[model samples]
Target: MSTLEIRDLHVAVEDKEILRGVNLTVNSGQTHAIMGPNGSGKSTLAYAIAGHPKYTVTGGRVLLDGVDLLELSVDERARAGLFLAMQYPVEVPGVSVSNFLRSAVTAVRGEAPKLREFAKDLKNGMDALSIDPAFAQRNLNEGFSGGEKKRHEILQMELLNPKIAVLDETDSGLDVDALRVVSEGINRFRATGDTGVLLITHYTRILRYVKPDFVHVFAGGRIVEAGGPELADKLEAEGYEQYTKASA
Candidate 1:
């Protein structure tokens, strides 16, 4: 089984400290949720693990199956079974969705897949996410609605089949129907029992649909509380006020 270990991570953006001594571990067959208020550095933790250049890792290490990921480039991290679905997916004006996915699969697999086989797999993933076949020809996220963009991210996670997937605020801006579809995709991924998921969000609505094995509360740029799934219920009931106050 694969394991992603984050050890006392310290991250900064524009030389301003963000994450402070954040520590967590996710193993295959498990899902961990990171919950927090706005500006609690939740997204920073995700970007840092994904090796975003803007978020500098000032201290500690991120290891996937014992290999230090902080030492690898952004694309290299994906090849090592680490995937990051950004909170705000950028629009690629010219690249079609199919082309973008194919390139990503090629990079991660170190070779290209046969056209016929890739086509079949792509169709199946889109079908699962309720994505329109016409979307394959559209520019990547260029005009996709919030729900569509999030669904596309899920499609990528399925195709790439990473050992660990970091979903950063994927639940944001999704309506009820879209939320269910996205949650189902996440549930489908974890059901394989071969991937670990680190779902970062401010609300626990997604958790109700895709339950996590562990829940962490973030405040003041670090995880201040942690527990089982029940912790999420507490957060939903009481909000982040208690945790934020404690951190302050």
Candidate 2:
């Protein structure tokens, strides 16, 4: 089984401290949900884990199954079994989705996938996410709708099958039906029992479809409360007022 442990994570952006001594752990077959108000460092934790150059890790240790992830570059971290589904997927104007996915797979696997097998896997992943087959030929996220972009992110997750997935507000900008489709795609990934999911979001709606094993409330750059599934329900009804006040 794989494990992702964040020990006393401290992050800064533009010389301003954001994450102040945060810690969490996720094991394979488990899903952890982070809910918090805006500017509470939820997305910062995601970007920090994925090695985004914009978010500087002032202090912390991010480990994947006991391996120090801080020592690796972004691409190296991906090869080491870490994946991030960005909230805003960038537009790759010249690269086809099929080509981008294949290249990414090759990089992570350290070898090219056979053409036939790769085509089959791509088709299956797209079909599972309710994405049209023709999307493979289009430039990555170029002119794609918000729902389409989110679906594509999950498609990558399905194909990559990384040890840990840090999804930043994946449910954002998705309509009701699109949200269901995306949530189902995530559920499928969770069923593998091989990928640990760190789902960061502000609302509890997605939590209904993608149940979390643990729920953490983030405020003032750190987790102020931790609980189980019930915590989500509480957040839905009571909101983050209490947590925000506590953090203040």
Model 2, 1-248: lDDT tens digits are 99999999999999999999999999999999999999899999999998899999999899999999988999999999999999999998999998899999999999999999999999989888899999999999999999999999999998999999999999998899999999999999999988899999999999989999999999999989999999999999999999888888
Model 2: how far residue 56 lies from native, Å:
1.1
The lDDT for every candidate, in the order shown, is: 0.95, 0.95
Mind giving the per-residue lDDT tens digits that candidate 1 earns over 1-248?
99999999999999999999999999999999999999999999999999887898999999999999999999999999999988899999999999999999999999999999999999999999999999999999999999999999999999999999999999999999999999999999999998999999998999989999999999999999999999998988899898888988
Q: Where does candidate 1 clash, by residue pair?
A: none
Q: Looking at candidate 2, what is the lDDT of residue 70?
A: 88
How many angstroms is residue 17 displaced in model 1 relative to the true structure, after the best TM-score fit?
0.6
List TM-scores for all candidates, in order.
0.99, 0.99
Q: For candidate 2, give the lDDT of residue 82.
A: 96
